[model samples]
Target: MGDGKSSPNPSSDGEEEVRREMPAKKKVVVVMGATGAGKSKLAIDLASYLPCPIEIVNADSMQVYQGLDVLTNKVPLSERQGVPHHLLGTVAASEEFTSKDFRDLAIAIIDDILARDRVPVIVGGTNYYIQALVSPFLVDDVVDDITACSLNSSRELKSVDSCAGYERLKEIDPVAANRIHPNDHRKINRYLSLYESSGVPPSSLFQGEAAKKWGRADCLRYDCCFIWVDAALPVLDRFVDQRVDCMIAGGLLNEVHEIYKPNADYTRGLRQAIGVREFEEFFRYYFSNTMADGTCVCGNCSAYNSEDGTPSSINEYEEALEPNFLEILNSNDNNLKVLLCESIDKLKANTRKLVRRQKRRLNQLKKYFGWDLHNVDATEALLSMPCCLL
Candidate 1:
């Protein structure tokens, strides 16, 4: 009887060991919210709560690029509380890091973390990045290699007239044409490019099971827990404005100044960052009018050459002008001052609008994709947290 009981115990222990060895579904935590909602802080704080180690994969499109740290609002290393952050400021500033790029890179990172028995915390305000990561379906997935390069090339699309592009899309895929606004040249171009590239109708990608389930919760590539750190619109708006002001105080101008170019493409790369383009007019005017000696060439300002003497060469003058650019903000020139003020105002306004748009998109994701988002209201925290904490 004792021998038989010991044999049964051995079998039970083997079953338990097998159960322990079985692979569990990988879990990923996504912390998403509007800009300035403390998503970074919350994601870092999660490390203390979870049983496993956590690594962060940044999903912010702009934050992926190197430089412009203040303008992009990237979480500083010290503020990260020693959490290993992946894909943060890793891309070249000149390169366009698209949603597809993010999805591919982030999945690899998340999988590696899971393989090591750690959770990946994806934190960012970029909704499309988050969507692409969790959903397997992407527009690029359908495109073949031959024409894929031309799919979203603004230069290639620019050559095609908007009306003609829409007409071409209508001819190739009328269902797609009717779904998008006629004036939405970008989408029109995308559809036409998709059809031309893959030799398939753009509308066909969404059919039957694919149409019903693509990007929905049932199609999620991984088990995900979504945390949306939200706040009241009024409170969020106020916080965003304050944050912008803080950013400016913290060397945002100098950062933007370093990247300013005469005809930089604002549609791509780090130049697409909000504060960069807004300051274009101010920088253009500043560089064009200010002399090497820091004298304003504008008719309204007095012409006072540098005490060190005017630069003998145009290049030398150009090099000397930058040091005095900030001082020009305090100069008596009303136009320069107005331009600077307007740019700052525009940055604030645009950021506020982005907050609303992000909130709406988050709501749409929940309503349409059946995302079970856990909302944590940070209104009180935003209202009460000191500037240093924020």
Candidate 2:
């Protein structure tokens, strides 16, 4: 993420001479929301209130890619107000950011902050990204085999990509295939290692509804007090529209263009976060001097939904003033849910609710995302939840 390492610990001579001090560690606070929800803004403001200098551990999915200052709506440096942020714009376009990578990196940053008596505030709207930091979701290689990993390099295994991994998982553990993120190479490789080393699939071992790891209801640790910002859907949609407008106005197009020209790894890989694909449409459809709207004309676009937009990014994004975004947004995840925006407002509302609910559950579990699930969704109502959201 952010290559910004915490500076070396200063000699305690000056401060230590004054008083005997207790070893105090950093406390972490996470601000979470959905796309278009105000997460970074809140995190930035909250930094000023921490007991020590805040080292922001960014958890947004898109912000890690370098040079994407505008498209991912990279938090402006001025807005940071000088509070040092970790992991905002660090990785190049060619590199990939994985949850396991995030976990290892974050633990280091958090520990560094604690050693320096600072607070670490982890913030972002990407739910999974935040979970990677605070949760107990283990990503260890299949305990059954140690030699398997040693035999293969991470790049060699990861090169298989999620597609091949998914196919393999289906043969080994079909149930897990349904749940694992299609793009999650880490998990896939882990599963692949399991199959290659051990004879059975991981899902078969965890083959029960009681398998809490696969459950979606879990999120936060058991001791967290959760608060969620609530707003009506229509209002949030308006906010999303305005936010996207601001990104476009703030030179997001240029940032995307710069990255696109480089054809770097991140640009083609993770940089496809959100708006990058939309602008690709703009480049194609109105490449010449055509005074038209710079909106996505993909399949779901009102224009494509109405008639004109096409699929090819080079054609739709490059030629037009507005990139054809409908097709890009309408793409689906493994569950067939559209990866793109259905409604910005609904996305903001539901995802925020999801985060709030997760934090509440985590507080109950006593470990972030570590809870005893009896494997029933409706059963959640039976437990008396703490009064924190108010």
Identify the leading candidate in terms of TM-score: 1
Clashes of each: 0, 45
Candidate 1 lDDT over residue span 265-286, tens digit each: 6666788788998899988877
TM-score, cand. 1 vs. native: 0.78
**Structural similarity to truth (TM-score) of each candidate:** 0.78, 0.56
lDDT digits (tens) for residues 304-346 of candidate 2:
2123323345433333344433334345422112322333333
Q: Give the TM-score of candidate 2.
A: 0.56
Highest lDDT among the candidates is held by which one? 1
Give residue 175's lDDT in candidate 2 (0 to 100): 72
